[model samples]
Target: MTSIVGYARVSTRDQNPAAQEAELRAAGAHRVFIDHGESSRVVDRPQWLACMDYLRGGDTLVIRGLDRIAGSEVMAIEIVAELGRRGIDLRSLTEPAFDTTTPMGRALFSINAVSAQLRVDTIRETTRRGLDYARSQGRIGGRPTVMTPDRVEAAERMRAENHSYAHIARVLGVGASSVRRALGAASSR
Candidate 1:
């Protein structure tokens, strides 16, 4: 007995997944699972995981679109490949030609997979180049320090005078954590 499991997702709470669910039901879905306020980038969605668990060999998993199942084309390809390996077919209502059971569909999916891989590779290369350039220019990217040198010196003086962290913080008009961080930074240097 083959089952058709439909999965619908919306990235935000304001977005409604009713239309996708309706389409999936109209397309002959045996069961439909909806996940609202869930990003496709997250693989641990409860409804999505339930749909995956409900699928068996020769079952079909339906989605409104590739983006409904995955945030990126790479993730989409990986998910579709995993379904194929599990002997489950993946069908996109919006992309009728993306069926993995057909040769032309497989070719189209392969093209998308190759494009996604190329895009990921390009992004990795660009990030490496940008980081290398920043390193050569002696520029490090991170959050700026909240405490200034003058505040640090004052905190150190207070600490040397037997003032507790909370006391130093009260004198410096900052949080105790800030005083501790200042002391730690001074010690590290």
Candidate 2:
């Protein structure tokens, strides 16, 4: 007999999985597997792996939403395709059109998956091009360094006066490690 298995995931430990579990149970899930503090980007989540292992051919895999199973469009497509290969059906409680029990649903899902992947690929390429353009214009990204030239000069003067790294850092309003690193970098140059 084919069974209905449920899978749920929460990104943080502080989040409660009770609501998801209750929804799955109400949806007639014979067994439910949950992963707490697990990111959807990770395919090797402990409970997810166990859920995949426990599933058999003809079993229906149910989830509250696609985001519970995948972090990206590529990941979601791969999972849905894998379910098809395993002779298991996928049904999303929130996304009725994603039910792959019928031929129409499967076709529509495949088309949507491809569209989603294309959008993701386009966005990534556009971002890459924008960054490249900025670099060509001599612009740099990321946060500015805390150790400026003036700070380095002051740190060196403080060190030469035989001040402790902790004292220098306190006076400089930075961390002890920052003072040490600045001094070390200056000496190296």
Candidate 3:
């Protein structure tokens, strides 16, 4: 008798997993593992890893969708391939055609895999173009700076008066790391 296991995850606690759980139960899953507040990008999720450990060659693993297993298409395909190599069956409730346990299912899975790969490639290309454009425009991509030259000068004066980094940051309404960086930049010049 092969066991059927279901895995469900939501990236935030505010989201409900009730629908996914109901679907898994309706599909006759013997056990269901739920992970809340876990990002789909993270592969080290406790429940997900535990589910993999509990599965055997004859067992089946079910998920709400490919995105539920992994945030990225590459990651989803890799995980699905790993399961196939282990002789474990994968069933997506949302994409019932991707069983991978039957010939037709395998073909369908192949199509989905190719589609996922294309999507990832397109996203990567778009991101590269966007970053290149931003770089050419001389726009910084990360968080905006919170300190100005005046703030740095005031922080330097405070530091020269033997004030602690924390005190200087508090007085200037900035962070200690900001004060330190400002001082470092000043000294380097």
Pairs that clash in candidate 3: none
In order of appearance, the predictions have TM-scores of: 0.78, 0.66, 0.73
lDDT of 1 by residue, 1-189 (tens): 988889999888999888998999998897999998998899999998988888999998888898888988778878988998999988888897777767788788888788889999999999999999998999987767667899999889989999999998888888999889879979999
Evaluate all candidate structures by whole-model CA lDDT and list the values in order.
Answer: 0.88, 0.93, 0.89
Q: Over 4 Å off in model 3, which ranges?
A: 9-28, 36-45, 71-75, 160-162
Instruction: Check candidate 1 and list the clashing pairs.
Output: none
Best by lDDT: 2
The RMSD of every model to the true structure, in order and in angstroms, is 3.4, 4.6, 3.4
Mark the regions of model 1 whose C-alpha exceeds 4 Å error after superposition.
12-16, 153-188
Best by TM-score: 1
Q: Which ten residues in a row have the lowest lDDT in candidate 1?
A: 96-105
lDDT of 3 at 155: 85
Query: Residue-pair clashes per candidate, as listed?
Result: 0, 0, 0
Name the TM-score of candidate 2.
0.66
For model 1, state the Cα shift of residue 137 in Å. 1.5
Window of ten residues with lowest summed lDDT in model 3: 93-102
Cα misplacement distance, residue 176 of candidate 1 (Å): 7.9
lDDT tens readout by residue for model 3, 113-144: 99989998999999999999999999869887
Please write out the lDDT profile of model 2 over residues 1-189, one tens digit for every residue: 899999999999999999999999898898999999999999999999999999999999999999999998889999998999999999899998899988888988989988988998899999999999999999989766677899989989989999999999999899998888889889999
**Descending-lDDT candidate ranking:** 2, 3, 1
